[model samples]
Target: MGLRGRWGGRAAIALCVGAGVWLLVTALRDGWGRADPVASVFGSVAGLAALVLALRAIPAPRPPVPRPVPPEVPEWWVDRDEADAVVRAVRRRTRRWRSGGSVAITAGLHGAGGFGKTTLAKYVAAQRSVQRRFPGGVHLVTIGRDVRGPAAVAAKVAEETRLITGDTVETGSDPERAGNHLGSLLAQRPRTLLVIDDVWEHEQLAPFLRGAPHSCVRLVTTRKT
Candidate 1:
């Protein structure tokens, strides 16, 4: 609560407490009146109200901020027109989020083996323009080409989240539910780009999904078309 709110709550408690005491004093001075059947009950409620107000005056602790690391800019970035194209697409999507315009939730690179898909994805994330678009920071988590169950996926989400933010995510064996929980965590960080690289199946990306279609975009690099 702000200064005004804390003082306002204190005032309310004082008023309620005073009102209750006044009622009791009035009953004692004038015997039990016909309409004064609930003097004790009203006083008890006033005490409870004061307690609640006091609790409300104290603010809750804030969650720890994530410490994200963007991919290091390549020392000698070579001729990769493909990498620039992907960066432009991501820039467009992030702009839509900034403009309050509708945008797709997921976008990334996909290509055959030895085609530099991971390189392009990392390059895009390392770009200055892309980094600026995603103020929350770009977090890269690689899910290599292999089959993984729901539990495995959830564990990955928790591990990466903890690594990036030091916030522990409660993940279950269910990918859908776990995704929702992780998504809520990511939702706290709007405009973040979560890159899940070397994906084999769509299910591999499920654990990283946000509960709502908010500003956080899930970018994946895959061999699949």
Candidate 2:
């Protein structure tokens, strides 16, 4: 029931309990010789009924448990050996950079629109190996046609990451500032994977490219090389 209903029910229960107590007390005050057995029995029943009502009126509240966030990847992905090969190659390249002590590594999957570049990037980002490498998290950001300039892209990334709660970073208009805020949040972790999908131009990717630590790896999917 809603809060109002629950409170109303409790109030009614309290009245019933008070009435029952009064009835029991009055019955006990009267002498047995002058008391009506029916009245006494009714009083006893009322007291019992009050006890039951009080028990049902209040309930213990339970604490909520937070659920784990699910990965952003396609279900029922069909087998594409060629696409898988490219994902593996990119993964290896990122791993090599990490081993070589590179601060940050950026790789791109460039191809025409219909060739499934975004799909391939998703597949790579969702891979078990990639998940293991980036313990911080794997975030995917799509650059739509309307998402012009770096600041807008940074805002989208901030919204997707949810690094800061409330109006901080996400509501900002400055792309450079938003990117710096996002980078600072990501830098707290040892490593993270950022998947930029359907990027049309280099400028669209520039703002987000800043602030990421060397351990962070960026995988971009675009039509441009």
Candidate 3:
């Protein structure tokens, strides 16, 4: 069926032909001159038929198919071994956290942004179990940029998450409306994780996060206490 298979099939036929010719020569040389001609011909035919059948029955090589797209595996934080264990734990605990509880992970060389917070958060988001927890898909937004205000942040998150915010959002919609729309979107999805990276202060981002649940865990990477 494939290139390799075709080549193999041709090679097998060549080998069978060579073997049949060698046997015929051997039979003639080893006193087949005294044997019955009809029986000799029938025997040769039967042997060749069986050899061909056996060769044809041999398995053919199948062509390799393209690989499936893998779910994102995050950049490792700390040692690779440690990250694997932590990611497994995070994946396991999403259900518990979404049930109105919280789970906090503090690792790496320091607290907040220095502690590989973003890396771990991404790992959690990418986990198969974690992805299942949020049907709407996890959204990661970096704050403290030019997009500082609540409205700007909402619009940015909506756009980043590929949520359909009408064209009017880019033209003149206020930040509150954008925030409200984002909140509504989160509400529609039963469980979601929104990581607000590099938060200068919790209060600054809180307004935009109003409709999102406590169950909808927010991973914050910040220097502030």
TM per candidate comes to 0.73, 0.57, 0.47
**Candidate 3 lDDT (Cα, 0 to 1):** 0.55
Evaluate all candidate structures by whole-model CA lDDT and list the values in order.
Answer: 0.76, 0.66, 0.55
Candidate 1 positional error at 178, Å: 0.9
The TM-score between candidate 1 and the true structure equals 0.73
Full ranking by TM-score: 1, 2, 3
Candidate 3 residue 88 C-alpha distance from true site, Å:
8.5
Best by lDDT: 1
Worst lDDT 10-window in candidate 1: 34-43
Q: Report the lDDT of model 2 for residue 47.
A: 61
lDDT of 2: 0.66
lDDT of 3 at 225: 68
Q: Rank the candidates by lDDT, best first.
A: 1, 2, 3
lDDT of 2 at 147: 82
Top candidate on TM-score is: 1
Q: How accurate locally is residue 41 in candidate 3, as Cα lDDT from 0 to 100? A: 68
Local accuracy of candidate 1 as per-residue lDDT tens digits, 1-225 = 689568869777786878677787877887778327666666677767777777777777767675466788677767587877788877777767667877778886778988978777888888888888888788888888554877787777777777655667576677777777777777776577778899888888876766646757778888887
Off by over 4 Å in 1: 1-22, 25-60
